[model samples]
Target: MKITFTLDTIDKAAEEILSQCQYKTLLFYGEMGAGKTTLIKSLTKALGITQTTGSPTFGIVNIYEGNGETIHHFDMYRLKKEEEAFDIGFEEYLTSPYWNFIEWPEKVSSLLPTNTTKINLKILDHTTRLCTIDNGSNELK
Candidate 1:
């Protein structure tokens, strides 16, 4: 699935993601300032999470509480090696039942689960973005 939208229509983009995504372990790929965090905030809102969401650039990971579930947001940009991911119990989190949204996933590509859903976001001029979704053979929910 591919979607192009402006910041003004981010909500609709988020809804399209929720409807088409096939897995909970989502790997977000984008350059800095490409609105990865912005899209994530909308996704959390769509999932019924009321709290404010932010990038976990420094903390590595941020946990958010939804109605009856948990959302694990990860920022691997600061990681220098895959071992850094394991040091933070990355495998444990990958096996969890909660939703996992990862940014800069290329930093930990080797550690990504086989069923990971890859979302690539590209800036298409200011205020506009093109998001391409690849579920990797996983069945859509």
Candidate 2:
């Protein structure tokens, strides 16, 4: 699925993505200031998470729970190597039956699962963003 949206319509974009998603793990790919974290926040809210969300740059991962669901949000930008992900029990998290939204997923690409969903975001302008979704098939849907 492809979507062009702005901050004003982010929630709807998030909803559309979730409705089309086929997996619980979402790998977010984008550059700095591309609104990856911003979109994840909207996603979590759409998933019924009531708590505030933010990037876990320093902490690596943040777990949120609400509406009978658990979400693990990961920020892998600060990781120096794939080993760092293992040190934080990243593999265990991936096996869980909860949602996993990862930012900077390229930082730990080798460690990512094969069945995950990928979301690519591009900044078209200061307020507009173009989002492309790929379900690990090497082709955008």
Candidate 3:
């Protein structure tokens, strides 16, 4: 599925789309200033999450308590090597029940799940974005 939006409507559109796909590992792909974090925030909010969430660039990972599950938000931009990801137990986090939203996943490309839902965000203009969802997903309640 592909969706286009301006920055102002991206959040709402993301929320609706994410709600249709429940409890799936989400990969956010985009360049700098592409509104990846903003989309994650919208997803969390749409999933009944009330806690605040920000980029995990510095902390590496931030956990949020949703209604009954954990939201593991990760930033691998600072990761230096594959060993570093293992040192931080990336596998454990990925396999866990927590809803993991990863940023800069290219740093640890080998570990990303093949069946993952990839959210590719492209910058059209300063405020416009093109998001493509190509995860073989079916509509869900």
| Residue 126, candidate 2: C-alpha displacement in angstroms | 0.2
**What is candidate 2's TM-score against the reference?**
0.96
In terms of lDDT, which candidate is strongest?
2
Query: Residue-pair clashes per candidate, as listed?
Result: 0, 1, 0
Candidate 3 residue lDDT tens string, 1-141: 778888678667877568555447787789988988988888787777899889999888888886886788888889888678887788999888778898887777788776567788899998888887756432111
Best-first order by lDDT: 2, 1, 3
- Supply candidate 2's per-residue lDDT for 55: 91
Please give the distance, in angstroms, between residue 93's alpha carbon in candidate 1 and its true position after superposition.
0.4
Q: Tell me which of candidates 1 and 3 scores higher on lDDT.
A: 1
lDDT score, candidate 2, position 14: 98
In candidate 3 the C-alpha lDDT for residue 58 amounts to 86
For each candidate in the order shown, give its overall lDDT on alpha carbons. 0.89, 0.92, 0.79
Tens-digit per-residue lDDT, 25-107, candidate 1: 99888899999999999999989899889989999999999688699999999998878998889899999989999998888
On lDDT, the stronger of 2 and 3 is 2
Q: Tell how far residue 62 is off in model 3, in angstroms.
A: 0.7
The number of the candidate with the highest TM-score is 2
